[model samples]
Target: MRADNSQHIVEAARRRSEYTRSKAVQALRALDAAGEPVTFETVAKQAGVSRSWLYAQPDLRAEIEQLRAVQRRAPRSSVPARQRASDASLRRRLETANERIQRLTDENRQLRAHLAGALGEQRAARSHTSPRGAASMHEGVDIADPVQPQQPIREREQ
Candidate 1:
């Protein structure tokens, strides 16, 4: 009786093992149909089997490894291609911007120098003129005014 009971238990265990293996195959098929990568983890999860069980199946293990390798390599090879294009475009834009900034800086310096020279000439003209005649070229507009040096508001406040 004990022998018969042990035999029955062994048969039940075998059936469960087969069921698990069948589920693993179904999982791989579902993944293929959905265009999903058949990695060990995904197959294990979908089949409700342990990773160890998937690895134990030599054919399935080999197939999963191949797919995983392809998935890994495909992305890495394409990334460098994309990065090269973007990097070159960015480098060109940066150089153009720097050149424009340099040109603007030079123009700004020239304008500042011209303004300083004009201001100096205006002061010299005012100093050379007598107080009675110390009026702007637009003398008709200064009927009730006098020519004088302007001081900053900060100095007046002080």
Candidate 2:
């Protein structure tokens, strides 16, 4: 009697498997009709099967995945091939900008050198015209006076 009961259980399981297989095929047809991407989750949901169970069927999984790959390769208007070419053109613009920067840097250095030479000449002329030991002519302050030169030091010493 136990053997008969076990055989009945096995037969019921087999029937359930066949039903699931038919359902999976129907789900794949539905996905194709809808023009939607095929995925394991979508297939499982449509077939009323668990995701783990669908994935365990390797042949069905491979067929659905190949369909998805074909969909991925189809062209879309949003990302055409010319955008990559534009990026290459942008690189050329960057090179031109770098050249301009280098030119400006050289001009700045030349201007700075000319300014330093002019300033040095002005300082030399001022020193030459001013009296010996006198403050700079441009400043207009008395740094030294011949009459009072030694008096301040002598008073401080005393």
C-alpha lDDT of residue 101 in model 1: 100
lDDT (Cα atoms) of all candidates against the true structure: 0.73, 0.73
lDDT computed for candidate 1: 0.73
Q: 1-158 in candidate 1: lDDT tens per residue?
A: 33458888999999998999899988977775565676889999999999998999999898778766755666433232213346678899999999999999999999999999997897578657836355443332433134555544467459
Which candidate number has the best TM-score?
2
The digit string of per-residue lDDT tens for model 2 on 20-83 reads 9999978977776666667788898899998898778988888777766655775332332223
Candidate 2: list runs displaced more than 4 Å. Answer: 1-3, 75-158
106 in model 2: Cα distance from truth in Å?
Answer: 71
- Model 2: lDDT equals 0.73
